[model samples]
Target: MLAGIRQALPEAVCLVVDDNSPDGTAEMAREFARENGCEQNVWVKVREDERGLGGAIRAAMQVAIDNGFDLFCNLDADLSHDPVDLPRLVETCLSENADVVVGSRYVSGGAIVGWPWRRRVMSGMINGFTRTLLRLPVRDASGSYRCYRVERLAGLDPPRNPSDGYAFIQEVLMRLHREGARCVEVPITFTERRHGTSKLDLPEAVRSGLTVFRLLATR
Candidate 1:
């Protein structure tokens, strides 16, 4: 994943945030950086605390913001997200002056491969539920593959989101919508992971559902 990203976006400052993965993901990324003479552009941040998707993403984004970066992009390191498509997303953000550019699977030209029907149905339901209930204007608020304007992300700096899991994706999008962010969605294909177990289980999905209600009630 690190090599692919470097090859696709040589100018990008890649920040890899790992929650102390037992597989030595952080060390491998560091080694990759050193070997490629990209020590200045590739950075690895290892979290010693409890693992949380939102926390990891927030920390990484904050680092970019504090370092005076104008743009920040994040995608799954599992190769589910295509690094080659990154340029299109970034270009859309600039062309549209969007606060965030989402790589959406529900939009035109978007497709999902290798997922079972049950998983697809559940995903669609959750996306539709969050979009309607949270009043998000975008079709795919749950997508983590996105490019965000550092300035817009900065406004949420002490991180207003309460979710630490997948719910954080939708909640943050909802919050940004409330803040009047101009969001744009670009088509992207989502391919299920061919290796490794998925962290999202039945319990996690239920929790995310409950969190949606919590957000609605709090609103």
Candidate 2:
């Protein structure tokens, strides 16, 4: 994913916020960046797991904000998000005058390939429920493949105890909307990763659903 992104947007700053993966994923990313001579444009951030996905993303956002980049993209390093879509989404946010642009799976042209029926069903149910509960117009509130305007995100104090897993995406979107960010969704086909097992389990899905309600209620 990093290689593809580097090939696509060589000038764009890419920050990799890595948790302590036992697989040495961070080392691989750094080596790739160095080998490609894009180390100046890429930075590897290591954080202990005091918080999870949401916290890591927030930390990255803070880095971007501190560095004076007005917009930044957040995505999983697992290649579920197509790096080729980055430029279009970044362009759309600037052209369409949106504060957030989501690479959506539930929008008009969006599709998910290689997921089982149960995964699809559960995703649909949870996103549908979240849409109703949060009143967010975005078709894919839980999508992590997104670009955010740093100014909008910087001004808001979003939830401190944000969900660590999939619900991390959900909370950020809802909070961005709640804080008056103009969000737009763009359809993107989500392809399953070829390498690893799914990070989400049955317990995590249920936990995400409950976490959504908890966030909605608290907000």
lDDT winner: 1
The Cα local distance difference test for each model comes to: 0.88, 0.84
Clashing pairs in 1: none
Tens digit per residue, CA lDDT, model 2, 83-191: 9999889999999999999999998999999899998988888888888898887988777899899888888785667677778788878888888889998998898
Q: What are the candidates' C-alpha RMSDs?
A: 1.2, 1.4
lDDT for predicted candidate 2 compared with the true structure:
0.84
The runs of at least 3 residues in candidate 2 whose Cα sits more than 4 Å from the true structure, single-residue gaps closed, are: 49-51
Over 4 Å off, model 1? 157-161
lDDT of 1 by residue, 1-219 (tens): 888888888899999999988998999999999898999999999999758887788778889889999999999888889898999999999999999999999999998999988888888888899899998989997789999999888886354547888888887788788889999999999889878876567887898899999999866
TM-score, model 2 to reference: 0.94
